[model samples]
Target: MRIHLTSVFVDDQDKALSFYTDVLGFVKKTEVPLGEDRWLTVVSPEEPEGTELLLEPSGHPAVKPYKEALVDDGIPATSFAVDDVRAEFDRLRERGVRFTQEPLEMGPVTTAVLDDTCGNLIQIAQSA
Candidate 1:
């Protein structure tokens, strides 16, 4: 009845791991070798047992164009909830994260979009 695992296609697993952990503050949960790729996943530090975010490889032929089109239209590959959008945006900007869209507030919700550095636009959102 609840969500379990989800994934974001990545161009490089190692780089994605670094960005997701060192930069975004997620922690590695599982890493299992699977032929040419690994079944790598990460979970929020605050929610160690929560849903896992898989760092899947973008080796499929259809993935490139799908990613490109999403980027071209300024769409996020996935969104992550944050306590405060502006604060998170500032923190991420200080770390040299490139944002396609700055924090914008709409009623009770605020959001910002940033490039994942692995071929996807990711969004950080907050709701008041």
Candidate 2:
């Protein structure tokens, strides 16, 4: 089966949407109100509706700890491919995005990790 969806836990849905769409440059694909919260998803501009990145709420105790543990281990919740890691990092910095790791060469690729502003770290990578 083809991969069409993935999820990242977020403390707040609205904040996550802003960071993903406004800062990280993903496009909103779907947004539906779900009682107190909402079911939100985003997709890369290039991919459009190809894949959905679900912004799941981290209100559940089990999910909150798991997400936090992943962050503490320096593992990004998700990674986005870019044409130029350095340029993308700079552009994101200008938008007030906080980065934990600056662009660094890693063998055949260059990558950087940044805070999503919603309790998750996201990675941006480019071919070397």
The residue ranges of model 2 lying beyond 4 angstroms of the native Cα positions read: none
Cα lDDT tens digits, model 1, 59-101, are 9999999999999999999999999999999999999999999
Model 1's lDDT to the true fold? Answer: 0.98
- Across residues 1-128, which tens digit of lDDT does each residue of candidate 2 receive? 89899999989998899888987888999999999888899999998968899999988889878878988998998888899999999898998989999999989999999999888899999986
By summed lDDT, the worst window of 10 consecutive residues in model 2 runs over 59-68
For residue 83, model 2's alpha carbon misses the true position, in angstroms, by: 1.0
Model 2 TM-score (2 dp): 0.94
TM-score per prediction, in order, is: 0.99, 0.94
- RMSD score of candidate 2 (Å): 1.1
Which residue pairs in model 2 clash with each other?
none
Candidate 2 lDDT score at position 85: 92
What lDDT does each candidate get? 0.98, 0.90
lDDT of 2 at 126: 95
Lowest summed lDDT window (length 10), candidate 1: 84-93
